[model samples]
Target chain A: MRWFNFVLLLFVTLVLQLGVGRLFGVGPQRVMPDLLLLLAVVLAFRGPADQALIACWILGLVKDLSSQAPLGSYAFAFGLLAWAIVRLREMFYGEHPITLIVLTFLCSFLAEIFVLFICSLKKVMEVESYTSFSLVIMFSAMLTAGLAPYGQWLILKLHRQLGLPRRRIYGR
Target chain B: MAGRRSERLSHKQIFTYLMMGAVVCMLLPVRVTNHLDHVLSVLVAPFSKGSQDMSLMVTDKIHQDDSGEVPSDTPEEPVDATIQDTNRLVNIEQELKYYKDLTDRLSGLRQNQSLDRARLIVAYITGSDSSNQREVKFLDRGTRNQVESGQIVIGWPKQIYKDNILNDEETDAIYEQALSGAVVGRISDAGSWTSSLQLISDPGMAMKVAIEPAPQRREDWRVKGILKGKGLGQISVHLIPATVPVKTGDVVLARSDDEGLPMDMIIGYISSCRRTEKNPVEWQILVQPAVDLQNLREVVVIKR
Candidate 1:
């Protein structure tokens, strides 16, 4: 995909995350899925190397910009997360909804932990308890993962319609 | 084959190095990073604000529809009548208070200090700080709205009614109850057009809270205590002597602070009460917030 198209996609997803996602209020903070990170995960598994990196890097930067957290926090976390997911792609089947769900869930969980660690190192902030926060992280992960299949499917279908062949995602 | 393998290995190394570079960049001077963040925020604000408005409109519509569809309950009418009677009594008490205030003002005996609701700015919460599990949210209003850090944000909750039947006499009471919605949180950070609020559910956050006296009580006996959030939907009130006539079902209100939150602002209702495990002498009270911290849409920020 052209770089401009990818950037446009990122912008649209960020808007969705900020606006439409807030309407899905399951708790005090709307328990909406993290669309930017979700898109990053989608690209990491299905897109070419350059596209995946650009998506992760841009999304992470946006996350940092929009949040009160320190800069580069999400960039590093998402970058590492994408790297890991790309490396692990060979171990599991890539096309199944269950695989995508599990991958998204695990990536989200790991990403939260990594960002928490970085924030702590910088003395940015501390939560009351990790045990309780873990439950929230788990719920958010599931929420993100629950929508993964559809997101990835749509992107993959769009790429196919554009005459981009489905590259062997695993071990590529 | 070896050449391709080496190329792939180099690609992985490049990825690792790039990740490391990004992490290292985070260690730059805080001031520099903050400036960059500010620049980015300027670019992101308009988009965030636009989306927040859309979300708020949708949520308001949903609440409107829900309000119209009368909920069903067992033996609903009689229960509603009972509630209505209770509300009527409370309304009478409020009317008495209003007259007393009027008389006091006429005689130069007293003056109310709490800021009027109209003076407060209504701000939309745009998003949550998802980096950590800390209960923080970003608001679309910031310094531009004269919103400052430590200003209290309040959620005005709708009163729970048993049935759809509207009572003519108690209609004003419903409006009164709605206005009495509890304090949701305080502004922890404020930008030019955006801010962040820390919820009362944050573990270490505390407030001076009290249980308002029963309507039937002739004596003004409010039990005051310090309430600290214990995370996970629980707040523990501290320094409450076991002897205090506090109990479950009593409505909790902010104990003081006429600026951020007035003494009369309802916080939540007491869900359970027990003696502290460590102190044994003081009471540990759990409050279920008057507002569902989950479904907040519009909130009033008392300008500090």
Candidate 2:
């Protein structure tokens, strides 16, 4: 596992997700992509399962701290998502760009669901306006899916520069 | 065969460890995290400053692109004397008009205590939180600047008056107390060098607002009501006493209660209002914030 490079990538993603993403949103809706989750999903396929789960946990912890959402919610959500994505890839995997796109959409959706479930259970925020909320979630998911491949490529490049061994969903 | 099982067991173990870590994190005292947040804000202050400057530059470029106009910061371009004269005239006109309006808004505050300018701290918005949380934004000012929680945040909208309403006199009378900037939110979490501001658009945020029709009108015509945030740039002023002459397009301004904010700062413009079938005694009014919050980049916090 390219643990050092992976952590570095996650750190950069965390900083961007914190506030820099504000630069990209447009229109009245102000949609911001979930870059941390995007990276976690990409790492799930490209890194060793164990290291990726650890990365997800750290990323989630950072997110929980940065946001007003209840602590442990994102940590649990991200860890569970990483674990589940790894299991899914091991069971049924593809190597094409479509695989990356679909995985991002699915993983993002899963993260949102897991976050909502945990938050609802904890009762920190009331679940309201499903129509608008889901639309925003779907917008973010689609936006993330659209950009996931390039991020994967960029992270792969960083790994290569760091002399880390590359792993894929399936053996060549 | 046992090797795979061992790996699976290790995976489970890691999961358990992560959960326990989260639990430990949650178990930590709130004050500890607040202190940690202060430290983190200080550590990131320099980076946040740089990013904020870059964001302003980027936003300027975007505005230039959308309007197809030459950016004002293009130093290489020849500066026309006529253009400079025109800009000066525009500035003078705006200042004159704003002061004229301020005269009316301050009339409301004249009956009350005057606001202290010494208490104002100009702060740049270092970053903004995404949609995952409430509509809160991070400001560059923090405890290091003696900016603590419960401070009032205000933003100056470029527009002098709310558009689409022809009643400029009545609107000016309602909004004049705030000078130029409208109340944005409170400094909810003040860190060491950075603080998060809960924007007025955040859900469940409630405040008292006064609705007035004309300058120095009778108390019988004035309405005091509660404005609550519904999120996504929507706010509603609720339960106005039915006797008050509340209308769809009336301007809503802060009505000082316990918050001690100046009563004349324009909260928003009421876009629509209706009496609920369930409660005809109350009027529900939808308000559009004076400034388009999506476009707000910088603000000032009032310590008092």
Candidate 3:
């Protein structure tokens, strides 16, 4: 994958995720779709195996930088999630938007578990009520899944410029 | 065959190493992680801030279109000339007392070594974190702008009093609207060009605060307590004696005990004051923040 394209994608997703994410938020927790996670899923399913995992890890790290989480929290989360997606891509049709949405929804939960683990280890979770915390996690995953098709479509359009393969290598 | 075999193992090896590196970062000390975060954050600050500005502009435009025009302050109606002269004298006297009260508060803050003459730095909100565990907002100004950690941040007063003398009606209006300066949060982390504001509602946040009677109350009652964030847009003021005559509308101020933070800044109003069922000696006071924290567009950070 082209490094320039990766950086541009990361920058735009980060801006959209943090800048206007609040505006699209629903409910009191202000839960919005996780744009970077969707991008991670898209690249993981479409890009070269080795490069996509690293790019997803970098995307997670960028999120960690912009947020108050421990530095490697998102990095580990996205990296592991991407690795899982790459390993399991052969099970489903990669071109199917429904496949991407389901994967993103599940992977978002996987990523959140990793993040919550790191935060707990760092002693920062400090969640007062488990019910509310669970609700936020559930809503965030659903929201990301709800918007996955559009986000994936947009990112996939840049595949040629990103130097990624025009089509998936699996489930042909 | 050898080359293909090596390539097959390379992906797993790389993933293992990257995961290990991430673990190391997670274990790294706070100072190191913060510095690294700051360096990377600077690269994207401009884009994030630009996006924030555009978002604000679009929101304002939509509201304007819906409302047809922006609201502006209208001039006060003229009154009887003789009555106006008498009111002016009373206003002058009231203004003098207000300034004196302000002086006393400043002196008290000085005595506590929390503030030397207060300086206000206007900072714009650039972005916010979506973490459920913490309430953190990003500011456009940071150390480069003399904004340091622990400095008090205040929102625009709900009502900017037009006249110095507040009559009974104006005084009620001011208190009902909110305090003269609404304490929103404090700078929790400062970088080269950006900082994080931990809002008072974050569960991890705790500060020394006091509850005082309204301006009309002649009974000089000041009860100091510890303010603990209860999350979900609420704060609890603890350790105040249950015997204190605290009510729902009493003003809560940031107590000067916290070092380097300004004193007597209005934090919120007591939404509920109840005797703790477990410990009747203590009061369970819930405060509604004076400002709408989630919608903050700009704030003034008080610098020493």
Candidate 4:
């Protein structure tokens, strides 16, 4: 039951990140911020690596299907993000809100640059448009970083409700 | 024993994930088919409607504010009898002119003795996805209406008949008015419930056009051309040589092959013209279409 709820939360977060976040234009240049990337990072740092991989795969597929870009682009970028986050899991703890925000900014920047690189290589978009492209990515990253602390608070609350062990710093 | 079980479970999980990814990749291209496109369009229609409603609300509010400031100050006086009488005489003259024009049009229709006759079906456009998928869902004009493919549809402009003449009776009238035109592309693939009307502005559309020199340049009227659409709300008339007497403000119309016509069906006037050096015998002419294709809701399909 707890596992199901976690998966559902991840799914809803991904959808909101793409749909509502896009509609509100809260991200970079009014583009949608990568909520799925943030979720994957959080999960990799705190939850099982296998679950993080699965979440990344599902979220990437959904984003690709909904967006105008060619398929497999988001999937490749997100899969790499999950792997990288998992590799860096030993360096940071999930309890630190500031660390989570900084990690989100860096991951989002890398993911966006990677997407732009792939798009340019495929001749889908011109390299000159990268100025506007970078603006949207930077703004989106800032917005996502701003929301990271709130997301951590919600994660902690959900963890408690699921009867998961609280961090030793926070009493159960 | 426990370690072996855990390893087997991990292998099974990897297989499941791989299978899922493979299935998603296969289905991605398949989802872009016509059926899925139509389904998604229907889903997105409501969002478009909401946006339109918001714009309308803003416009209506502005109109209300403008009306409040400019109240009519003139005291209502009964119209003068002499003025009314003069207006009545002018109205009769206009009616006679209208009836004469209508008679000529009907006579021309009767004289078309071509064996390759085409049929027409009057249909209303219910929905359209830009210039690409324009489906005209008629109000069940019935099978007897002979609404077939390749039929041309033309919208009749509103008729304004003189009130005093003919006791204000509604008579078929023809005046200088812009009418929307469309050709039937295909019938509904599923059922006879609806038919698709290919708009003139459609990318694949091509039609016969004829151009002549303006009346002012009748003495030097050595220029003639053909008009062709370049899609996305633009049209160009080609083949008029640079040395030929073609200029801006010259009238262009869909020339009828039928003889003894007093006036040509005016489509639009040439807005801009440029002489191409590569083709000295042709001038590139841009035309603003007379009929607003975007706002057209209904059109008449004339039998060819």
Candidate 5:
């Protein structure tokens, strides 16, 4: 049942990343929502850190292969995010919607920065001006944060339907 | 405890899984990967096509509404006849001039030792995708039309209608001259219905280029550069030194030294240029291609 939820989440994450995410223009800076990061955050809040880590690795690999970016960049960023979210779980409660939104925003922002950093390091992309980078990050964070409540709600519904407990849902 | 034993099994299982995965990665076939990429591109194409169709439909509707204002039913016979007669006279004069020019050009071709015999095939660009890298695919006049690989394809020249009126004769002349450009690259691969034009923009594409001496009053008039494509709608002309007075507006044309034939075919103007201190022998020159690459729906493939 846990495995099924993970697979379903992966499918939904990819669909949203490619479909609805693309529908929303990336803006002049060409920054779009990091749906995979959002999924990782939501999973980290409700499931075990280990499962979130695995999901991140798998999804990141898929993203790397699908996109024009170098491999393993997304996986590293996502794994770190999953670990951080799990460690912070004791300090924050997941029941609050605003908390979820903020967490999603922070994680997504970090993921984007990490990707940009990786690309630069790989010499695949030149670094944009600091001002442009900041604007893209701010806008992308706000957009992803705004959409987090719906993402959380979907995850919660799926968790319930699958008869999976909020705690101990993902094995450590 | 039972937990410890289960944990040990899990570790062993993971190890086995990782080993299997590594082996699979090493053994994966290139053809399988290419097929997967093709399938993914096909899946994504519909989304882009739908957006394109929507935009086109809106534009078409606006055009139809605008055209509705014109009185289409009005019978302007006398005006039409006058226009027709004028066009006929122009056509006769142009034909006589064309033959005379052709004769001169033919003689010049022989004297200049250039290849003059050629055939043309019209083609349409159906779709483009960058899976392995940026690639453009085209659907050309089929095998029945004798279209083959290594033939140069060029955009159909804009039809210059006589006074915004397109008579059949003028239209034919425009179509005939559609494939007059220099051969940059050729059909690398061919099929029964479609042939792949390995464009001059391909990374593997290589072609010889000749530079014309700069106009008088320019001290650095050494006019020779090789135009190489950097892929993704970017091209660079090499062998031009910083000392050469090449400016942004300077035209980079494809020139062949064969006598009797037109020497230079205009490629595009230089958009930006930079001199590399590390490479004093050459300057990196960027050229904005004259071809409207994104909108290339049809082209004429010429064999000479």
Candidate 6:
């Protein structure tokens, strides 16, 4: 993969996620889509296995660096999710739009759950209620899932630039 | 087939090792992680700051359009400029008056020493914590500007304008009577050129507060309570006796021992007050911040 292009993409997404993404928040909870998580899923679907693992870890590390979460929280979530996706890639048509959406929703939901689990283990936050926090995770996952198809389409358009293998859902 | 199976197992083992490495990183010391966060934040400060400025500008334009005000992009005529200048002068004069009043109160109480060292560092909002579980804003000011952790961050009170029978003198009077200090957040982490503000609405936040009389109330009494954040832009006061005459719209003031912030800075006003269903002896009071904390573009970080 073109590591430089991936880094640039990751940096821009991180900035946008932390800055402009707040404007798109909906409801009182201010739930927002997880852009970096979507990117990790999309890249993992199309990139080589070993490189994708490293890339997902890096993406998660960047998120951990910017957030109040403990270091490696996102890294662990993203890495685990990417590994699962890679292992399960052969079972499904990974490049299908529906596949992308479902994968993103599940990954986003699980990533948040994983992070929440870590936070709970650490006793870092004083959450008002588990149900409310779960609602946020669900809504955010749904939002990211809704945006996944479009985001994936856009990224695939740059696949050659990003040095990813061609889409092969239907065959070589 | 055996070779392929072995390859998959090796990959699984590698993945396990990577996850273990991540756990190791998570277990790293807080100081090391904070230092790393500070370094990374400083490196990307420019991108975050630029995007935040652009976002705020767009939000302002949208708000202006919704409010039926002239768009700011239009060229300002001399009269508009004059009006803007006048408004600036008025604000400065009002601030001076507020400080003077504070000084008088402190002097009368013989606690004026802390006021002498107090300084307000104006900082721009850069970004915020992107996690769903946290409510934090990133500021463009940090340790370089004496913005240490626990410094009180405040915003200007929402201006109250009268619709009818308002002359310049009446307007000035209303401005003068307006409660000035509204605490928004506190510095949770400070880097070289950036810091994170733990908003008062975050569930983890709790501060000493008092229910005090509004301007119209002639009675001089204070009921001290612990103000706790309830998340989703909600804060509540606890430990107040139900016998106290606490009502909606009563101003809540910070009673913190932090020297950076002056005493009695307005934290919010009671939005709801009701007796707890389980406990009849205490009042469950919810507060709405005086200023819109979510949309704040700039804030002053008090340093002492």
Best by DockQ: 6
**Whole-model lDDT, model 2:** 0.64
Worst 10 residues of 6 chain A by lDDT: A163-172
Write down the TM-score of model 3's second chain: 0.74
Candidate 4: clashing pairs of residues: A28-A136, A28-A139, A28-A140, B153-B300, B153-B301, B154-B300, B155-B300
How far out, in Å, is residue B60 in model 1?
7.6
Task: List candidate 1 segments past 4 Å from native.
Answer: A25-30, A68-70, A118-126, A160-165, A169-172, B1-112, B130-132, B158-179, B214-219, B230-233, B262-264, B276-279
Residues B43-96, candidate 4: write the lDDT tens digits: 333343344334434543665444565223322112223222322332333344
True lDDT of residue A24, candidate 3: 58
What DockQ does candidate 5 score?
0.11
Per-candidate total of colliding backbone pairs: 3, 2, 0, 7, 4, 0
User: Tens-digit lDDT track for model 2 on A1-172?
Assistant: 5567666666567667655776667446577788888877787777666777777877777667666655666777788788777777765554577888988898787777666555556554544575666666787888889999898888778777534357564421
* Selected candidate, larger lDDT, 4 vs 5: 5
Candidate chain B TM-scores, in order: 0.65, 0.68, 0.74, 0.49, 0.56, 0.73
Once fitted onto the true fold, the runs of candidate 3 whose alpha carbons sit more than 4 angstroms away are B1-12, B66-68, B71-116, B157-179, B214-220, B273-281
Off by over 4 Å in 4: A1-3, A26-29, A160-165, A168-172, B1-7, B11-304
CA lDDT of every candidate: 0.65, 0.64, 0.72, 0.47, 0.52, 0.75
**DockQ (Cα-based) for each candidate:** 0.36, 0.42, 0.51, 0.07, 0.11, 0.54
Q: Tens-digit lDDT track for model 1 on B1-304?
A: 5555533445446556667767777887544665454454455556765776667556546655346653445354455345434444543444455456667788676444443432467665565554435556666677877988778877654234212212324434434443545678888767786777777876546778767555655446667788777655566677778888877766666644545753245666678888757878877778777666645555667663
Model 3 Cα RMSD, 1 decimal = 7.3
TM-score winner:
6
Q: Poorest 10 consecutive residues of model 2 chain B by lDDT?
A: B159-168
Score residue B221 of candidate 1 by CA lDDT. 67
Q: Which candidate order results from sorting by lDDT in descending order?
A: 6, 3, 1, 2, 5, 4
TM-score of chain B of 2: 0.68
Residue A120 C-alpha lDDT in model 4: 59
Give per-residue lDDT, candidate 6, residue A6.
91
Candidate 1 residues A1-172, lDDT tens each? 5666666676777666655564564575445577778888888887766457656877888888755567788888888788777777778787679998998898888877777666667766546577766777788888999999898877877674432347646565
Once model 4 is optimally superposed onto the true structure by TM-score, how far is the C-alpha of residue A58 displaced, in angstroms? 1.4
The true-versus-predicted C-alpha distance at residue A117 of model 1, in Å, is 3.9
Residue B187, model 1: lDDT of 81
Pairs with backbone N, CA or C atoms under 3 Å apart (clashes), candidate 3: none
